[model samples]
Target: MDTYAVHAEGLRKRYGGKDALAGFDLAVRRGTVQGLLGPNGAGKTTAVRILATLLRLDGGRATVAGLDVAKEPRAVRRRIGLAGQYAAVDQVLTGRQNLEMFGRLFHLDGRRARQRAAELLARFDLVDAADQGVEGYSGGMRRRLDLAASMILAPDVLFLDEPTTGLDPRGRGEVWDSVRALVADGTTVLLTTQYLDEADKLASQITVIDRGRAIADDTPDGLKSAVGGDRIEVVVGEAADIPRAWQVVAGVCREAPETDHGERRVHGLVHDRVAALTEAARRLRDEGVAVEDIGLRRPSLDDVFLRLTGHRTAEEKAGAAV
Candidate 1:
């Protein structure tokens, strides 16, 4: 109904003396996927729980689909869907059975429940596995069924918390396709994940959070620009050439190149990728500095995350693991 499907301002949460969310703010636009990126204990899930009306906030305010989660949780619940980190389907039940059970819990009549299950089965491409017990389903199929369960009411907004954490590449791709289909049908989504590539592919905008606070928010390109321009990187064939390689890269790029002594690598930002690449190669050739590798590449979301979070998402593995 509103421009934002979900909105939060100054959200605060506390567990004993430790803060889970500290004055956090976020906005997810309608009909778009907004990646809530953060390391473990960075308040990504805390903010989601507050907006989803599953947990009470100590301070601040949030709303979903134009209804205040705090003042009108029932109204918000009717307009939102939530799929947590793990698949939330029954192992003993058939894929179709799981959908029907969720439909019944949502108050659909028996006929309507069965019909809804069939619809979800087809929608998620689970028709072949519909009658099969979830126990035999692959990780991807089970997760898809879990997502279908969340869509029982076809809520306006969906909150996906690391929908593909443990899946292999193929399984993760399946979940990604399902999410894309939902967005195509105009569902707004808030996705949280540690996989930078997932956000790079699916999120129209990204919000970077750390230490229970909002650190950066923007489109993927915008966030990457915050780190620096295109990078010029070189690996010298000989360790002794590292210093000279750095000088060449720094002189051409006009920035000091960062060196990895162990790898004999030097990298830094550059103004023009094509020109920088050509010039660096030529300079190395002229200077007799043999290079093992060289390239000009754009900054990835991983670079942006490291610049903002001060770590390579290591904290998320144990704490959030998203």
Candidate 2:
């Protein structure tokens, strides 16, 4: 058997004149969670769909559980389960019925299906509400049920696309807990999320895509360090004061702001963050300028995205574009 649970090479997909996934490649090891992050139209969704066998790739090749996604899609489907951006469940059916139905569809015997349904209901903390119609379920409850449905077959691999979108903090935590449980059971997962924190908490490795291409791929810490070790954000009173500040702090700086937009910042790998901040403060005081806020912090996933892709995540970009 192939060592990887999922593998892709030169994966490509297009819509109209635009490329959705252009020459993308990926490898996810067994029993590991790999995160896909990118801006809007970055092809995260397209890649997930192709791997789940919902859409045929226009070019390249992929395999899940050692079964070719293109030539043996049915076999791939049999070993994999997908939970998409939206929750999918029978509104008219009770939560228990919904899971049981999926179990039956997976060819489980009636007694086994019932047993699996009960097991999932308790696992996801839906036992008390198990008999309620899905339509009456809250967004979080419905999402949990959708996840439960996907696991009826005890799939070797699972694909979760924006699993936590539209969920409150409690809801997000619930889903996170479910994913941890799945991983503990030795299941491999391929997850896509717009939330950087979600990737930080769940992904063993991360691949960032932008405009249908992989921009950066590594462990989360590796990507963060690649951008810069630590950041010192400096807020100054006047735009004219930025240059004077840079002069004192620029030697240790890998990148500094030449222009000010309300607030000016200097960020880079620094030998000592405290030393840099002290120099910045001393320079500003000599110039007779008031410093508002100055602090040292580690590079965030957002910072990495900004440096590599020249844009924020999908939601942030959408808000900015508006």
- Highest-scoring model, TM-score: 1
Per-residue CA lDDT of model 2 for 13-123, tens digit only, reads 989978998999898999989999888778998999999999989999999999999999998888998999899899999999999999999999999999999999998
Q: Write the per-residue lDDT of candidate 1 for residues 1-322, one digit (tens) a residue.
A: 3799888899999999999998998988999999999988798888888889999999998889999999999999998899999999999999998999999999999999999999999999999999999999999998999999999999899999999988988999999999999999999999999999899999999999998999999999999888889988899899999888988898888677799999999998888788889998999999999888898889898889989988786534455664
Candidate 1 Cα lDDT to native: 0.91
C-alpha lDDT of candidate 2 relative to the true structure:
0.86
Off by over 4 Å in 1: 315-322
- Compute each candidate's TM-score over C-alphas: 0.95, 0.87
How high is the lDDT of residue 67 in model 2?
A: 91
Task: Score candidate 1 by TM-score against the native.
Answer: 0.95
Give the distance in Å from residue 103's predicted Cα in candidate 1 to where it truly belongs: 0.7
Provide the lowest-lDDT 10-residue window in model 1: 313-322
- Which regions of candidate 2 deviate over 4 angstroms? 16-18, 236-248, 251-261, 264-269, 278-290, 318-322
Consecutive 10-residue window with the lowest summed lDDT within model 2 = 257-266
What are the lDDT scores of the predictions, listed in order? 0.91, 0.86
